[model samples]
Target: MPEITYRDAVIRGIAQEMARDNDVVFLGEDVAKAGGVFKATVGLYEQFGPLRVRDTPISEQAILGAAMGAAMTGLKPIAEIMFSDFFAVCFDYIANEFPKSRYMSNGQTKCPLVVRTGNGAGSRFGAQHSQSVENWCMMIPGLKVVAPSSPVDVIGLLAAAVRDPDPVIFLEHKSLYATKGEVPDGEIVDRLGTAKIVRPGRDATILALALMVPRAVEAAERLKAEHGIDCEVIDVRSLVPLDTQTILASVAKTHRLFTVEENPRLCGWGAEIVSIVADEAFYDLDGPPVRITTPHIPLPAADILEDMVLPTAERIVETVRRSLQS
Candidate 1:
């Protein structure tokens, strides 16, 4: 049980998948020679060779379209959109082409493609490079969106995404790339749509995704120390096929709910989580569900403005406190 950085774990998962299946190939800008913008695919090019690990052009559309074509013809293409914001450039191919091809063609074709991208706001990446757009993909019908918060989860979930039949949007928070955590030595595949309860408690349930999980956990620890609140933290690892049952059950026991996400408040993943809670666990909730998220503005370039926009641990704690009070 060796501890490794989240970036390393993801690289290991991709390397292992490539070794296991010759059909599994990685395509993205800088993926071949530079080992990816974040080095998540380091050493992959040398190990798998140029044919399997390719560096594509700057166009996100071309990258996605090539992935779709490769997937439809039998290869499992893992295409990387350097940043989550750039994913918008490939929306047509992702939402309509890859996700709908199988159904549109009467089940004659299957697009088992995994679109990997970096998300979240940090490191002064400015507004354009640091947007969390997973919610947009989650809105699509056939696309499966996943955001892993830890090294262990990232390794396991990426492997699962690669193996799945449907097109998967695998979002890794750029800020968490260097964060270290325990990851199993061998290949590990986390089941899709499963919500992991990181911390068990009876006072309230705090659901978080991606980097927000760590923030929620920190808030939970502070709540226990300051307000004597026992908060259960649920990592809704997979966003699209959300694990509503686990969330509802946690809310049932805790009687209070709150969600933390990096995206903006309106029409974001937090809204979707709140909607699910309202539908399935409305009566079970002792108070209104709260969402700690960014404001409905573009991610700012200034550090001070950026800090104010993104959800913080303090915000999560305050939201939990408010939920408890209500």
Candidate 2:
């Protein structure tokens, strides 16, 4: 294992998958010559050349439509949306058509559309560029959504997303791109739709998705060291095929649940996680499941305001303590 930046891990995943299968291709605006907005696909253009690694026009509708058409015909395309918030532009292709083709065709169609997008509201990108909309994908039918917490997880999950035969929304956080972690040099493909217990505890369970996972983990540590609270941190890696069993089992032990997410609290993914506990393991819970999320408002472009809008480790710790007390 070697320590690598999150950006490197993503490029490695795409490169490995492309080398293994001839059908795997990367396409997006500025993905070829510019090497992606975040440089996730840097050096790939030189290695794979223009045919496999293509730069599409600056239209989300066109990029998604073209990718769906390519996937249906024969090629496996990994289309990149520079920002996750821009998904609104291609809702027709992403939310409606691409996901429904296989279902409508009744097993006749194989929808292997992989849309890799960067999400999150940090680094002052503001409301336009920095929105965590995983909940939208979770609500859609026939879609598999994946969000990795670390460089290692991204390597495995990205590889898994690229290899999956269904329509996979591979999501990465804007903040995690520069974060470094250890990753295996050998093949390590994570199982999509499966959640991982990132940190173990017994006092309470903190379910964090995407960018919140690391913050929750840090909070769990602080809670244990400072307040003598052993909080279990679970990263809900796969949003669509959520690991309900894993979550239920953890709740069975901890008896308290706290969900942390970057999306607005109103009808967000955190509510769904809390709803699941209320439905399945209500009797086992010592307190009501609490959701820690951004207020129902858009993130400000100013760095100071953005810091206040997003959930933090301190916020997670405070929320878990309050829930445990109740």
Candidate 3:
């Protein structure tokens, strides 16, 4: 086992899959020669060559349309949308085309393609590029949405997404690209619809996704050290096929729930989790489930304002402490 950065893990995951299957192809703007805007796909161009790992035109719609066509014709294409925000330009292909092909054709067609996008805040990319839009894709039916918090999960879940029989939106958090984690040697693949209990405790359950996962874990640590409020932290790695069983079990054990999310307050992924907990595990809860989220506003371009808007470890700790006390 060795420690690897999240950025490198993306390359390894794509390479591993492309090597295993000849049908696997990659195409995106600046992905071939420039090695992607974030350099996450570095060395892929040389490793996979120009034909398989190609650079596409600037049109997001064209990229996805081509990928969808390729997937329909029996090629497993991994198309990068550069920034997740660009999904707005190709919403038709995402919401209507790829996801619906299998259902409409009654199993006559399948779109086993993966849409890889750089997502989340912390690079000061401003409102347009920094929005955490995983919630957008999760709301749509017939799509699998995944956001990995660690290097190991990046490679493992990515492998799973590539092999899946349906469409998958693979969101790579911009902030976590530099973070390092230990990954096992040799083939790494993880199951979709699985939630990881990163930190276990008995007093409260803290659910977080993508960038919020680390913050929630840090908050749990501080809550224990400072206020004696032990909190369990769960990393919601996948959103569409959400692991409700894991979440409900944690809520039952802790008897309290809190969600730390980078998405805006309105219709954030945490809200859905809160609704589920209230609906199914209402009796198991000792207190109302609280959601700590970014205010409903466009993300700021300035570093200070951005930091203020996104949920932090301090905010998580304070929110959990206050909610538990009340």
Candidate 4:
């Protein structure tokens, strides 16, 4: 095992995938020489040469359109969109084109493309640069959305996304890029739609995704220490095609559920999960499932206001407590 940053794990995953399959190509803004906005693709151009690792124009539409074309033409393309906020520019290509192309062609052609982007608020990049756009992508029919919380999961899920036959959106939290964690040696591929129960407990279940997983785990530990409450933490790594069975099973055992998400409460990912729980495991609930999410407003540039807007460990604990009370 080796301790590496989430960014390094992503870089290693891309490099390994490129080495394994020559069909895999990397393209995005400043990805070739500058190694991407976050340097996630650093040294890739030097290793794979220009044709495989290309630096594209400053248009996400162009980048995504080119990747979709390459994918349709028998090549696996990994397109980077700098920030998740910019994905709005290419929603037509993604929602209408990339995801529907293969099915529209009667499964004759597969769009094996991975669109990687950075998301979340905490870098003080303001509202434009920081937004959790995963929920928006999850709304589409033919897209598989994955958000990894730690370095190990980041590497594993990225590799899985690259190898997936359908169009996959791999979202990396900007705040977790520098976070270090132990990643196992050799290749690892995490199965899509599989929820991981990071901490097992008999009391209550907390469903979290991406960076929220770590926060939930911290809050679980704090609850156990302070109030003697055992909270089970389940990481829903993949948003679309969510592992509803696993979540329901956990809720059945714990008899209570609380979801933590960085997105806003209105039309947030938590809403979907809560709906699923209500529909499937309504009888298993000991109390109403509570949701912890950001305020329904643009992320502020100031650190203090940003902290107030986003979900935190303390908020997660409070949500769990409220769930128990209700």
Q: Which candidate achieves the best lDDT against the true structure?
A: 3
Per-model RMSD to reference: 1.1, 0.9, 0.8, 1.1
lDDT of 1: 0.89
Model 1 poorest 10 in a row by lDDT: 317-326
Q: 1-326, model 3: which lDDT tens digit per residue?
A: 68999999999999999999999999999999999999999999999899999998899999999999999989999999999999999999989998888888888988999999999999998999999999899888899999999999999999999999889999999999999999999999999999999999999999999999999999899999999998999999999799999999999999999998898888999999999999999999998889899999999999999999999999998888998888
Candidate 3 minimal-lDDT segment of 10 residues: 98-107
Error of 2 at 83 (Å): 0.6
TM-scores for every predicted model: 0.98, 0.98, 0.99, 0.98
Q: What tens digits encode model 4's per-residue C-alpha lDDT throughout 1-326?
A: 67999999889999989999999999999999998889788899999999999998898999999999899889999999999999989888878998887788888877899999999999998999999998888988899999999898888888889999989999999999999999988888778888899999889999898888899999999989987889999999998778888998999999988889899778888898899889988999888888888888988999988988888999988878766765
TM-score of 3: 0.99
Pairs with steric clashes in candidate 2: none
Q: Clashing residue pairs in candidate 1, if any?
A: none
Show where candidate 2 strays beyond 4 Å.
Answer: none
Clashing pairs in 4: none
Q: Pick the candidate with the highest TM-score.
A: 3
